[model samples]
Target: MKIWNEPYLETCCRAALHRLVLVGGGGRPDGLKDGPCLERLQGMGLARLRADGRYELTEAGRERHAGEILKLRKAG
Candidate 1:
């Protein structure tokens, strides 16, 4: 995770980054979102959410991380 350029996205509640990113896009941070970034990252096999309030990085996630993050992809 340190190797990636992932900006520390501020989440309303601890959860998968997909939900946070989507919700942080000026939308209310509810339990779910109309469009979650999780699905895209999921497609990339880079991120996931557990039953707990945590979004974790997978093996592929480390590889996608270029460590050039200037800002959160979507920050509210």
Candidate 2:
């Protein structure tokens, strides 16, 4: 089995992930300023683009958010 090492994310990308979570994880773009951040997140397997063309957090992204952004500990 492969171990999961958390990828390093920039401040902007973290903010973008938080925003994605706040917005219910899909639908509607609040402008296009986050393209680069989204791309980075997508490349890291943290976020994914939906069929409707909106970006949302994957399971890893949500876990990252809970740990990094929200400062919550993950339960084993």
Candidate 3:
């Protein structure tokens, strides 16, 4: 697993937030499916690339997503 740092956490957290918003709106954009952004999350084991080229949240990702939401709620 990749080391968790402030920058990486921020990136992943923001990505998680974006994913949440997109999921709520409908779905992810095509560009994000196989993009480097998702790839980074994939490498971190927070996301999985499906055979259809879509990203699905791993269990870790679900936790991260919930954690990110908590952080944001606290920040606000």
Best by TM-score: 2
RMSD (Å) per prediction: 9.8, 4.7, 5.1
Error of 1 at 63 (Å): 0.7
Global CA lDDT computed for model 3: 0.62
Candidate 1 vs candidate 3, lDDT winner: 3
What is the number of backbone collisions in each predicted candidate, taken in the order shown? Answer: 2, 0, 0
Off by over 4 Å in 2: 1-4, 28-31, 72-76
**Clash pairs detected, candidate 1:** 5-67, 18-38
* Per-residue C-alpha lDDT of model 3 across residues 3-71, encoded as one tens digit per residue: 666335556446654574457424344465336666676778877767665666677777777776667
For candidate 2, the per-residue lDDT at 57 reads: 84
Worst 10 residues of 1 by lDDT: 67-76
lDDT of all the models against the reference? 0.44, 0.79, 0.62
Decoy 2 TM-score against native: 0.77
Give the per-residue lDDT of model 1 (tens digit) for 1-76. 3464544433422245433344432423324552255545555566665556444555555444422121344342
**Which residue pairs of candidate 3 clash?**
none
Give the per-residue lDDT of model 2 (tens digit) for 1-76: 9776888778888889888888874542634798899888888888888877888888988888988888723443
Which regions in candidate 3 have their CA more than 4 angstroms from the true location? 1-7, 20-30
| Order of models, best TM-score first | 2, 3, 1
